[model samples]
Structures are given as C-alpha cells and as structure tokens.
Target: MLAHQQQHAVSQADLSVLSLLTQDQAPSPAQVASSSSARGQPHASTHRSKTKKGDGRADVDPLLIAAAAASGPDVTRNHYFHSFFPHPLAYSACDDERAALNASPPGPSTSPPAQRPKMESRQAPRSIRLQVEEEEKRRLERLERLRREQMQKEEEQKGVLQDKPQAVALPTRDGGFDFQEDGKVQAQASQRDADRIKAPKPGQVRHLQDDSLVVLLRQPSTPPPLEHPLAEPPFPTVGAQSAVKPESPLSAPEPTAAASPEARTPLPPLEVQCRVRTRIPTPHGHIFLHLYTNNHDTKEHLAFVADHAQMASTSLTTNAVEGTPILAETGERRLLPFIRSHSLDCKWHDGETDQERIVRGAYVGRLTETTHIASHPNPHSLDPTATPPHVHRSHRTTHNTSSQAPTDPPLVRIHSECFTGETIGSQRCDCGEQLDEAFRLITLAGRGVIVYLRQEGRGIGLLEKMRAYNLQDLGHDTVTANLMLGHGADMRTYGIAGAILRDLGVAHNGVRLLTNNPDKIKQIEGEGVKVVERVAMVPRSWVLAEEEAAAAARRAARKAKGKVSGGDKRKSLDASIASLQSLDASSRRPSDSRSTSLASSAGPSGYSSRAPSDIDGELSDGDSDSSDWDAKTDSSRAYHLRRAGVGMIGASVTSSPELDKYLRTKIDRMGHLLNHPTQQGTLKRVMSSGGASTPGATHQHPLSESVTSLDGSSGEAASR
Candidate 1:
C-alpha cells in the first residue's frame, strides 16, 4: 500500500518537473549530436547507434551542439540529454545517477512483482483490523437476526398448533394441515401448551400476564359455500365419505303429501285412444260413399263396398242436383253419420270440367278422401291432345307439386292360363287354387287390375308342360323336366306385365305385391316399380294341401341347393307361377264354352262329386279333369301334402280348434307312414341284402297295416 502511494506521488512530481523543463524551446538533432560527439562519452556512441536513422551513423546531439556552438554550456548539456530522455524526470534527475532512480522505480514501471514482498513485510494497523472485526460482527448480527426471525416463525406455528388441536396431526412438521390420523391433533395441542410454558422465561411470563389470551386465540375455520348445492362433494356416490354436512339441496327433506301417486303405488297403463277414418264406396248405383270412423286402424273397421255401388269424396265437389248425402237407391245410410262427422271441407256440388286430362277418354279425376275440394287441372295435366300412354307417363313425372314422383298404380299380377289344374282338375300343382285366391284378394281391394297373360307353362306352352309331366313321371323333377323340354327352367318374362303397368300409370310410387316369390318381387321391382306390400295368395282346400307340399318341397330343394327360400325368394318363382295358375283357374274362368262345359259337368248328377272308388280308380270328371288324371294325381297329392303341412303349422294351436284337429290327424298319419313296421322292415332288409329288394314275393308289404298306420283305416288311406 505504501509503495502504491509513493508511486502515485512520484508520478505527480514528475509531471511538475517535466512541465518546467519543457518551458524553453528545444535544440535541433544535428547540433545536439555534434556536442555529444565532442564530449566523447562511450554512451554517446550508444546514443548515436540508437538515434542515427536520420543523421547517417552520427552520434549527434543536435540540440547540444547547437547550444555549445551558440556558446551556452548549461544549455548544451541540458539540451542533449533533455532531448533524449523522457520529459520531467529527464531534466530533474542526474544523468549519471542511476542508483536512486533504480532504487525508486518510475511510476509506470513499478509493478506488483517488485512491491509485493515489501507490502507483506509490514503488519496491518489496529484501526483497519478493528474495522474488519466490526464488519464481521455486523455479519454475525445479521445471521442472528435471520435465526431469530426463523425461530419466531416456528413459535407462531407452535401457537397455531396450540390453538387448533389438529395442527400437529399432520405427517409433515412444515405446518401444513393434516387429516391423515386421529388423536394426534389433541396430543399436539397439549404438547403445544406444555411447550409454551417451557418456552417463556419467568420474566417473559410476567409480561405474558399483561397480554390478553383472547387476542392470541385461533380464528374459527369456516368453509366457503358450494357453487352447486345439488352436486355431491368430490367423492364417489357409493363411498361412505359421500355423506357430508346437510348443505346439498338434494339431501333436503321432502314432504310426503305433495308426492305423486307413482311414488306410493304404481298403476296399470291407461288404454290410448286413436282416431281413424276410412272412405268406403259402394256400387249400388250413383256413386254411394260413406266414411267409417273408429278408434282403431284396422280392416275390420272398414267394410268392403261393392264396386260401382259407392263413390268416395273427390277433390272436386259432388253435384247438388245429384241428390242430398249423395244417396243411392240401393245403398244404405248406416255410415252417413260417421262420414258427416269426420269429413273435412266437403262440397255438395261438383264443378269438374271435362277439359281436364284423360286416359283413353276416361277422365283422370282426383278423389279427395276428407275434403271434396279439387284443384283445377294444370295446363299440362296428362295432355290428352298427345299420345295418351306417353302423356300419362309424362304426367306421372309432375303429378304432385311436392312429390318426388307420381303415385304408383296398384300391383297387378297378369297371370297366364294353366289348363290342367286351372280348367281341368289337373291338380299336380296349385295353379287352379292360387288363381282363385288372387282373384278374391284383387276383387276385395277393388283397386287392382289383373292382366291375364296367355303365356302358359312358363312360355313353353301347355303341351310342353304335359310333355314335361311325362318326363317328370319318368323320374325327372319339375325343373329338370322343364329344362329337358328344350326350354329354360323358367321361360316366362314380365314384358307384357310391364307394358300393362305402364299403360295403367304404375311406374312411380310402387305396387303392392301379391306374391311370395322373391323372383316375382324382384322382376316387378326391377321394372321400375316399388313393391310396397305383399299379399299372400294361398289356394283352396282340395289343391290347398298340394300347393303347400310343393312349396315346402321346393323350398327344401332350394335350401338343399345351398340357397335359402322361405318359399318367399324369387328362386321359387316357378313354384309361385304354378300357385298363381291354380289361383286363377279357381277364381276366373274364361266365360268361354270350355269353362261352361266343365261347370255344367260338375253341377251334380252325371257323376259330378263321386267318392273315390279305389286307390288308382279314376276320379269322376265332374269334380276334377280326367284327361291327365295320372299326372294330376301325383302333382295334386304333392300339392295337397305341402299345403296341408304349411296350413297345419301356420294354424294357431290354442286359437284354431278345428285346424288343430286337422293338423293332429295329419301328424298322426305322417307318423304312421314314417314309422310303419313293414316299411322299416323292408328298409332294414334292403340294407342288409346289399341294397336289393325282394323280386316277386309281392314285396310281402303289409298293405292293411301300412294303411291302418297311415290313416287308421285302409279305406281312408286308399281314398286319400
């Protein structure tokens, strides 16, 4: 520290002396060098060597030589070295006095390397040492302050523990709330009180006597109100912890007086009431119509009215001149009250004009069911001026302003002729019976049109069907026989049906199907018509059993072919056609001579309904056709068995007592046939004898036993 101070002082002194030396003007180098050479000092040569760059190897002190030549000794000597050395020190210090200068090194050159040891030699003064000691003492005081602050914090925590018994129950001593254990809180409180007594000195206790204990008492803890009182606390509903203070509104008590009856005793459901209305038309003459209103939407509430005997409400008004209540002489007014009550906006006078659109000269009038309000025909209503059929098709595209397409015409099954089962009682199939059923349903609906196609035997012609029958007799199945007759298994198509539907304007909304055949459904559907509903057309009693058996067998065969047909799939279309043919024959006979002759022949006498003579005896021509009796018998038998099987199964066991009896009889007969002892014996013998049967032993078949087992009587079995 001294050396540093001395160096600083010397630097200030040097600046002062240097300022004095530089006060006069200095001499030039040439003169200074000349004088220095004259001096002959060995250091003069060193000077020359050092400062000879501008003077060419000359040890010349130009300033000194100039001063000497100018006759100034002091000026010459002083100028020489003064010009050569650094300012201030150069002038004040003796040029040959190196020892003192070396002793006290120049300010700039006095480094720590030289002064460090000297500094270490002196002991520091007591005042500085005392200052350091005081500083250390202040630091120690600060540390004590922090310690005291920390201790006070701990004391405050201890006081909190004393106030709140649960404070010390926590696992952590860091003073967080603890809910993990019991009893620890009370124990902690007692310990805190004891610690308090231990913590204060006698003097502190005296001061404490002056302090109020109430001011130190802990504040009571209260929870904030819940945001949603109806909601449970943060715990599972099933847990025991879920039950908290009665703050939840859901947990509030309820009054029993205001509770509903459902809360006490539940009652049976009340019957619902619905309103339904049906517009029925009768054909007793003059368009007679009546609306039937009921609480149920069922056909039983809507009775069938004969065609041309009734007229439903139309969008147009009925002519008042026609008569009040649109009465018909032959019609009854039983449903008038219901109609008047349910009708909406009905009109008494019809203002319809004949200028409207027409199909084949027949006016296409819209019949409004509820209100008899009709809209004037649009400018392009069917366009009768053009081709009626095409115009109708076009009109369908725009009939309803809001509808996607025109309403579809009712589905019509234009079934073709089948002579054997249909006309003649050739009931190998159900052609006759199914035809009858179709006619009945269509006539009942009163909105369907059946186009009778002439395509018989699936377009192979009736003769071929007979031929196919011969093949079938030769062991060919129905499909195989048809295929063998130089035709597809089914050659019929729906081209004519399509044309008929088109003519009838049914290409839009869709048609209600009356068939179980998926093929027929697909065929019509594929022809741009929707199949809304399917009405099953089953056959009559005689061929009814045959129809069912054939259907089931066909279904079985189809199923065995690895395809499923509930006898409803299109795969059974051929079977359906057969059924349809049976229906048509039984229902619609061409009012021609052929049907008349057959009807006359079956009208009693002339051996019309004769009983079966024998097992193979010919049936009287009256009841059934005798032309193909052999083939008919097989087909009829198949049909009868199938129909009966399906019918028996379909009949409700508990509901239909008569049907139940019939089914029971059938089941018994089937069981007898299946479990007949002779048949079983024959089968066993055949198996044992390498699949060969007795040649001419009359087969030794127990005919009476078989017959008795089948139907409990030989005569019954033979007759069947």
Candidate 2:
C-alpha cells in the first residue's frame, strides 16, 4: 500500500506538470501559490516575497544600486531608466545576427533588381566635345597648309624646283577622291620616278639637298660644275685671295700682328661737372660747397673751398666802417689762385638768364639780396691763358708775393666718408676730429680745399661697414675684417676727387695735402693732381698731451726756483711771474723740437711715466687746492685761464681701450702715419716695466692723466 501511494503521488505530480505545459497561458503567481498550498508545500511566490522582504532591495543590480547611491541624491531612479532599454552592444549583436541571416545565399525575394539601361545609349554628345574636335581638325588642316607653303618657299629659295609648281595633297579622314590638275599629277609622278632611279648606290657619292658636297664610302670625286660658273663664291677662300695677291718669295711674309695681352682698349676718360655751388658759413669761416656729378659714379661728391680772396674781401668790406684794409698784405690772397667751379660758371643754355645763373651759384662776389651779380660765362676758364671771371685785381697783384715770402701751398684734404666716425662721433677713428681740425686749419691758413668723397668704409657700403664692425669685435683688425668679408683692405678710389679738384681749378698748382695716409697721397698724385707736401694729422689727444707736459714743466721750474731761493715768498712770486711770461711766449710759438724736448723731460717725471692711480690722486689733490690759486698774481691767473680754454677745445675725444686698439691697428697694419703716444713718450704710458703693456690692464695706462689734469684746470678756471 505504501509503494502504491508513492506511485500515485508521482503520477499526480507528472500530470500537473504536463497540464501546465499544455496550457495556452502560463500560470500566474496566485495560481502557482494556490497549487503549492493545496499540495501542502511552501509556495514559490511566498518564498520569493519573503526573500525580497528580508533583503529589502529592488531587482536592480547591486553595482548599479551602489553607483546610484554614491552619485548623491541628484541621481534618482530616472537616471537608471536608460539601463532598462536594450544596450547599444545588444542592438549591435541583433544587427550582426540579422546580417548573418541575410548573408546566406540570396533567395528570389531578396535579390537586388537589375538596373535599367540609360536613356542615351552612349555618353550624351556634348557641344564642347564637338567644338574641340572641330578646332583640332581645323588646326591640323592649317598646319598641313603651312607645311606645304614652307616646303614650296624653301624649294624656290634653293632654286632646285624653280619652274615646277608644288601640288600639296590634303589629308582626308574619310576615303574620298581629291580633285587635282592632270598636268600637276603627271609632273609629280615623273619626279617620283626620277628619284627612284637616281637614288645613290652604296658606293656612290650622295649630294644633300642643302649644297654640301659630302663624299660617301668611295674615293672623293670632283664636285659637279656649278649651274652658274661665273658666280662668285658665297665666302672668300684664303688660298684664292692669297693667290690673287702674290708677294716676293725672297721677302719674308708680312707678319700679321698678334694680339698682345696688354693691348686692352682704354676706358673712356672720366668727366665730371659741378652742378651747383653755395656759400656755407661754418664755425670756422665761410666755405664754398660745390656739389659735383661725375660720369664714373652716380654719387654726388663735394668740394669745400675756403677761398682767401673772397673770404678776406668780404670780411674787409663788412668791417670797412672800422677802416680795415680791403686786401690784407698777407700774400695768401695773391699767391693762391681763386678757387671756382668752371662748370658752374658756364652758361647752361642759350635762353638762360642772369637770374638763373645767380640762382645756380654762378655769380661773382658775395651773393646778397641787395647785390646779385651773375658771372660771365668763360668756357676757357681752366686754360692757362684764360682768366676766371671771378678773379679780381687783388688776385692779379704782381707784388712778387712768392719772393716776398715763401708761399705755403694751399691745403687740400681728400676725405672719404666715415659715417660711423663722423656722423655718430665714434672714437674708434679720428675722422670727425680730423674733419673739424681740417676746417680749423684751413680757416687759419686762409686758403684750402676739402674734397669730400662718398666712399664710406673705403668703398664698402654702410651696411657692409656695420657688418665689418661686428667682424672687428671678434678680435680681428680692420684690414683683416675687410679681407674676411671678401673686400680689399682699402678699396677707395680718388678718381672722382681728382675730377672735382680739376673742376675747381685748384689742382693746377700743387697742394699741401692734410692727411696721415701715404696711400691717399700716391693715389691723388696719380690722378695728375700734385701733392707737394704731406701734412701729418696728429691726434688732438696727443696735442693736448704735449701742451699739458709743457705747462707741467713750467710749473715745476717755478717750484724748483722757489726752493733754490730758500722759501723767500717775494722771490717765489717773482719766479712764478717770470715762468708765467715764459709760458705765454712758448705757447705763442709754433711747436718745434724745443716743445718736444720739454714733453720728453716731463714724460719721465710727469704724468706719462706715472701709473694711472698715482695720476688720479694727484689730480684729486690739484682739484681740492685749485681754490687757493685764485689769490695768485694776475699774470699767473691769466695764463691758467688761457690754457683752460684750449683744454676745452681738445677734449672731444677721451682716451679709452677701444681708441688705443684702433690707433694701434691703424699704425701697425694700415700704414697710417700717426705716432702712438707710447712711442712718442708723450701721454699714456702704455708700456710698463715689461716690453709691452697688457691689453686687459686698462687701469695701468695713464691715458686719462692728461685728460684729468686738463679737466681739473678748466674746472678751476671756471670757478674763478
């Protein structure tokens, strides 16, 4: 009975499961719970509800719940609503499955329909294509016609088919008959037949269409006779010409002149014209600045003429109320020829008026608003026999001025442009100072000329000159720097300068050239401008040094004399007065060996031999005590005042290491005729106990000693 009962229970469980499976709708939770309750078992729904109640959580994943909780209260259940939808990856999976299902062999229903044929069988006939084809056809036809005409012209020019008419057959794309004259057709046929028969064989000579007689594989044959036997050969043959003119066999053939290397055609002569001239009143004196244009170069070179004749006359006339002489008896005005530009004085055109001439600076005497006198044109002004219109009677004075006094030649300085030194006041070169000194000297001399050439950096332009400055900063000398930049050491040329000098009528007589460069002298002399004397241009620093040394010596002499007199106050004052007189006299005299000896004596015991530090201390002491010198005698005070005034004038350039290096390079390498301070034993003790002073030790050099003394003395004079 127990076995039967277990079997019946098993059969009933099987029947329930079968009935549930056979039902159309799945059983709900209520039905499942009822069935379980009836069977005396725990309902699945009840167990699930107990589990959910005990866990106290929704059906959400624990990770998602934790994420939501950590996201803060801003994230609610709505934030996770997107998770309920299908994941993008799941959609991709569905797409992949669909693609796989579709990837199987296509059935009739899924196959793509066949594309219908295009309405136009081929590509649509484009008008542009038709136009292009027509144009190409016309171009080909034109080319063929041109070719036929060219062939016909060539044959006629060659005289090969002079009587035959050329019949050109036009090319046809379609098979078509071409109309032609029967005679032309027959002629072409005959010509073709002749060519076929007359073609040259392997061993025969073939004559080219062009008149060349080239021999082939066999021995050369005589050329066929010309159609016109009397015609002259196109080119003359040397043998035939020589045969025509027979020479004596005994006499050597006339030697033909062979070209010599030195036989070069000379360059055209350089011509220059003075375009304008104007009187410029400078600090020194009045100068006539003449601008010149030359054929050799486009640069407008300048000439600064300090004409004593004109300047003296003007000055005398201006101060005539004071009864000054119209012409001074200095003999400079008579000896020096009047410097005038020939080209400027010449009439520019036939219709030119005196106002035009005066406006262009072609006038005689001083040009003033009240007095405007245009000079007469004198084309032969430069000729020896011709006299310039501007030359006055004072210039023609035959007082034998040359014999009365030895006339110093008119000073001339050929100055090349130095933008760095002149315009910017650079001390690397003494160019600006030299220019200023030149003006001062020329003004004092009463007659001179300054030809200013526009050759900056010795013909290298300003840009290259700046580049050379950088090169010089790299421990190279000026010459080496120029050479490194593919330039000559000095590429300056004086041709324009010479031309300008000639135009001014100053080069006829020799000039006393103010320059330290021997090369400039040689070059100017080569231009047919005579340089009778070369005036050395000593630096102003050196001049100031010499003056200071002399002054120092006079002071020392006074002091020593005071000591010899046993501190007698009156005797010392007397000695000081005498020394002051001597100083005045010496200062008035021109510099000579006496001044040089004084400088040498002062060099050993004065600033030149002293170290820079010692000089500085002495300068300080002098500055402190300068106030006491005011109580000295009037003569002594006057002497100091004069020296102080001179000091201010020569204080433009202060001594520095760069200036020293530049001077050294110019002296040692550039062949400039300047004396170094150390060599002269003047100022600046550049050489120490050793043979040469070190470049790095600038403080040891006494270059600033002279400068300091001058400054202190000037300051004392100012305080007084």
Candidate 3:
C-alpha cells in the first residue's frame, strides 16, 4: 500500500513538471525542488545548479539528460518553443531561459552547444556525371557533322546549277521550238512536240518537210557520232538527252519476221557447260560428279556419272598432248562408251596448260599427285594417226571392241532436289529412296547417268514446298496443295538436263530413262534426247510386299507338304503352290490392265509399254536373265533388306499414310505412270459405277478412268 502511494505521488510530480514546462512562465528553483521531493528523489535542479557553480559539473546524470534531448519533439515541448540551450535537458527551454543562459556564457553553469551528427549528401558520383556529359557531347558532335555534310552537298548542287547554262527555246520553220544551250541543240523538242500534238491517222502517211527539220549529217565514211540518239526519245525536258538507246545493229543483225509489236525475242539455245568434275566415292560406288552451268538458269545442276569401266580403261600413262585413249593398251577393251564432257575437255584459252586442265578434272584416268594426264579436246576422236603409239593401239582395240559390244543404252535418271525427303528423311515421299535406288541401279549397270537438277519441290522451291506441306496437313493432296499455292502440279523442266546429257555424249546415242512420270519422259524427249527404253522404278515397299507374299506362299506350301504322306504330300504342295500363283496372277491382272490402258491412252508416241525385261534387267544381278523372275526377286529382296534397310526400314516395316497419299496424288492427278496396290478396289468401284465420275473423284485427265480406278486400294492397304 505504501509503494503504490509512492508511485501515485511520482506520477503526480511528473504531471506537475510537464504542466510547468508547457506554461509560458519559467518554473522557479524552489518549485523544481518541491516537485523532485514529491517524486521521492533528491532536489536535482538546486543541487546541480550549486554543483555547476562549485565544481563546473551538473549533479544530474548525463544519460538522463541525453535521453530527454534525444526524445523527439513529440515527447518534449521543444517543437512549441524552438530555442537552443547549453544544458542538454533544456532543449525545449523558453526564450527567457535561453537569453539568461546566453548572457552567463563565461560561468561554470554554461556548457558548449550540442552537435548533431553529420549526414551523407544525396548527389551523383563524379564518374557518372562525367559519363553523362561525354554522351551529350558526342550526340551534339554527330548532329553537327550531319548538318555540315548536308550543307556541303547543297552547296555543291548549287554550284553545279550556277555553272551550267540554262537552255532556251529556239523557234523552227514549222512553228516548233528546239531547246538550245550555248548555240548548240541541247534537246530536239520540236519533232516530239509535233508528234504528240497530232497522232498519225490510220492508213495516212505524213511526209516530213525537209525545210521544217534540222538534220546534223556526217560523211558516210565517217563514224557515227557517239552521242547520236538512234531510238525514240523519252519525255523531252529543257536540256535532257534521250534516255532510251537504240538496239545495237550488231546485237540483232537479222530482223525477226514477225511484225507484231507483242512478239517476243527468241531466246538463245540452251547450252550447258560442265564447270567442274570430281570423283566422289559414295556408299554405293565411285561416281564422277559433274557440276554444270547453263544458259537457261543460274542454278548449279549436277550429273552423277557411274562409268567404272570407262575410268578403268583410261590410264594415267596416256599422252596428255594428243587424245587420251578410250582403252588402255595393256587392259581389256571397255564395254561402256567414254562418257566425257566436251566442254570440260576443250581448251578454255590459249594460255591454259595441261596442269590447269588436269586441275579442273579434265584428265583421262585416276588423278594422282605423281601422275596426272590431261585429256584432249576431242578425247573420243578415233584418229589413230593423230594419237601416240600406245593411244593408237588402245583406240583401235576400243573401236574393235565397241563395234562388237552389245548396244545396251546407258541408264539416265533426271532427279530433282528434295530437301525434305532427301535431307530430312521425310516419309511423305520416297524421293531419298528413289535417289539412292537410282544411284545403285546406275552403278550396277556399269554405265549410267543421274542428272540431279536443283528444282526443289517440283520447282516451286523449299519455302513454297513447306507451305504446301501445311496445306497437305489441312487435308489436301500434294497436287491440290500445289495448285492452292498457285504452282503447277509439276513445274520442273528437262531442257537443262538434256543439254547436260548432250555435253556428256550420253543422249546422242540413246538412254534407258528411269522414271515413273510420263510427263518427264515427254519433256525429255521434247529436248531432242531419245529414250530407247522406259525402265520402271518400282518402290522398295512394293518389292518388299511381293517378297513377303512369295515367302508366305512358300511357307504355306511347305506346311501343306509336311502334313501329308509321300504321294499325297507332293499333290498337296502342288495344289497350295498353284492356288498361291492363281491368287498372285489375279491380283496383278488389274495393275497390268491399268498399265496397258494408260499406254494406249497416251498414244503410240507418248509412253511406250514398259517391257518386263527392262524391269527385271534393271534390278537383277548381272548373272540373271530377264526370264529369271525368282532370282531377280531374291536379289532385289536381299538388296533392300541389307543395303537399304537402314534408310528405308520404317517404309518397309510399317505402312506410311503420308507416302500412300503422296503416291495416290501422283497417280490420280499428276499423271505419273505408277501402279498402286490399292488400285484393285478403285478399279472395282469404277467398274461397279459403270465408269461414271463418282463424287469426290479428283482425277481429271484423259487417262482418269484408268488412274481413278487404281486409287481406292492404296488407301485401304495403308489403313490395313
């Protein structure tokens, strides 16, 4: 109870001291002592005042004084009466107390003024300020430099205008005027103005008056003036000369017979020059890759020539000065003709040396660092008197051998570049597989050529081709997609390919063309190349299917034989084999009919019937004859399973809906001469419909009946 009373008394004293501090009048020393005594503390004010006078130190605690000073204006009355005092506790002292403390400055009661702590200045660093100044300076400099250049150009133009004399119009006899400067005719505006004023009437000739015209004639022997304008003038200005120059007489000496203004100038004949040739060793075999430049297009078309015998017969020891022999003196006669590029072997210039010719791959045999023999301009020329002793002997031998050699034409395939199918292995098309197959076939044939044309996506280009792919994803066929993108079904041309063939001496004799597109055959033949025979390039998938069917048939025959007695076993096996053969024959009849119908519809001159021998001969081993279907089938099956398995495994093992659709489009719309397996169902549908055009039928060609009939089964097969 006593402690509580004492706390109440201290609170009361604190309240009294706060009230006294808030008042305008200063509290007396006696009052401060009474307040201290009521709070149960010593009379600190009076004691501190006496101590300050005696020992120069206040009796008050320094910590307590500092606490009162550090306490913000909210806690203290310093905000009400702003004044500084020597005493730290008297921070909020009134004006009278401040004046009294200031007056007694020399006494021990006075203390030095309290110092507030220093604060950091809020300003940018010196480096940042300098950087900003430098950037501003550079910007100003750049603007000034631009301004100076512009002013200089304007001054130069002004000087040019000032120096050149302005043309004045001089009246002519026909009331027309000529623009003259410095007494010379700067521009003849009279004739142009007169012509524009009155156009010539139909069937009316306006005779030009000699007196009205001013002619500047030179002697017949003298050369024509270099500044003479031979053609019609452009819009006549005061001093401008004619902008249109006449077509040079030397450029086109013979005038075209066509007088129509819309007649176009005939383009020069397509000429291809083999720029470079190098031996590239591929996975199949070594091929001489020839890069060609043509007058028709800027693209670098290529030709992969597979002539192993030609390379083997031509030796490095052959004379470089004369013609290189088509056969080696010591070697056997070559069966294949020497497929050499005439443009590449021809002397490029009089200064061209044998080393330079050899460097450009115009050499006879395998080019080595130690032995390099350049080829002659007419390497195939059979003039024994002009050749060296060994070359003459070899040439005679080649001539004799070639005379008795079989007249089998070289295989030629015109393949377009396919970035998606060939480079990325796209399943949508069998382009990469076809290219590889072509290379293999040509290499196996011992003498062939594959012209790799740079016509990506049927000549629409890669960008458009990718766009076409998107359209295909949107449920459009390849032909329809190409049409939607404003491109033809097949925009490729074989003129350059034909020219390249001519340069290589392959098209001159004949070529067994490998292609499924009848249009390609037509276009190639149009280019003056003879296609002796048409070799069908059957898809590897179809080959695999045939092999599988053959295998299944054999397995069934074996199973039937295994379950019977000796005499009955033979009969059962024979029956099974006969049934399988009958089924195979039935299945192939429709395809055969379709091919025959297509050939007849194409007319006699269009596409010839593909001989079974050509197909078998193309894929068969050298030992097998055309009639040996079993051997040929086994050979092709083994090749696809072994050599092409890595690249075409997916195509062989599983069905490709994209590939099926692509093939269907080619057969139905693009007029490609290919037989699809699904053609059986389509033929049945067409026959059932009485050859009427069914709804959703896309085929639109003369051979559409035959083509559409062959389409329905491929989709069903792909689904299966």
- Clash count of each predicted structure: 58, 0, 3
Please give the CA lDDT of all the candidate structures. 0.33, 0.48, 0.51
- The residue-level lDDT of candidate 1 at 87 comes to 36
* Tens-digit per-residue lDDT, 1-720, candidate 3: 743343233244456656655554455556656655654454443333333343444434433433443443234553433344233434443455566556665757555554432335587899999999999999999999999986776466445434434333333433433324533554443665456335644443222322222111110111112232222322111111111112232233232222212343333445567777899876557889999865545678999998775566444322332223232222333234467776787766543434345546877665543334566656656422212111210111211333333334677899989987777668899887778767766665456899999888887678979998999999988876766665556666677787787777666456767766667766776676667655555555554454344445655775775645657644644564453333322221223222122111110000001112223322232112223543545544444333334543122222389988898777666545565655322222221122333222223322223322121232223224
* lDDT (Cα) of model 2: 0.48
Cα lDDT for residue 341, candidate 3: 78
Which parts of model 1 are misplaced by more than 4 Å? Answer: 1-401, 404-411, 542-720
List of clashing residue pairs for candidate 2: none
Q: For model 1, how does the per-residue alpha-carbon lDDT over 1-720 read when each residue is reduced to its tens digit?
A: 743343233233233323333444454455345434434445533433444354344433445345443432234333644434333333323444344457766577654332111113376799998999999999999999999986786577446434442211222222212221231434444453445434544334322231212222222111122122222222111111110112223223342211222333221211111111233232111221222221111111111222221134231222222211321222332111101111111111232112111111111122332122222233123222211222221222333324223322343454656666566545365455445444334443333444444557755568878897787677655555654544444455443344334434443444454442334444555455545543333223312233234345655775587745445443343453443333323222212211011110110110111112111121212113233443546544533333233222122011123323322322232111111113122211110111222222112222111111111112233334
TM-score of 1: 0.26
TM-score of 3: 0.46
| Candidate 3: pairs in clash | 678-713, 678-714, 679-710
Q: How well does candidate 3 score on lDDT at residue 469?
A: 97
Query: Looking at model 1, which ten-residue stretch has the lowest summed lDDT?
Result: 595-604
Reference-based TM-score of each model: 0.26, 0.45, 0.46
Better of 1 and 2 by TM-score: 2
Top-lDDT structure, candidate number: 3
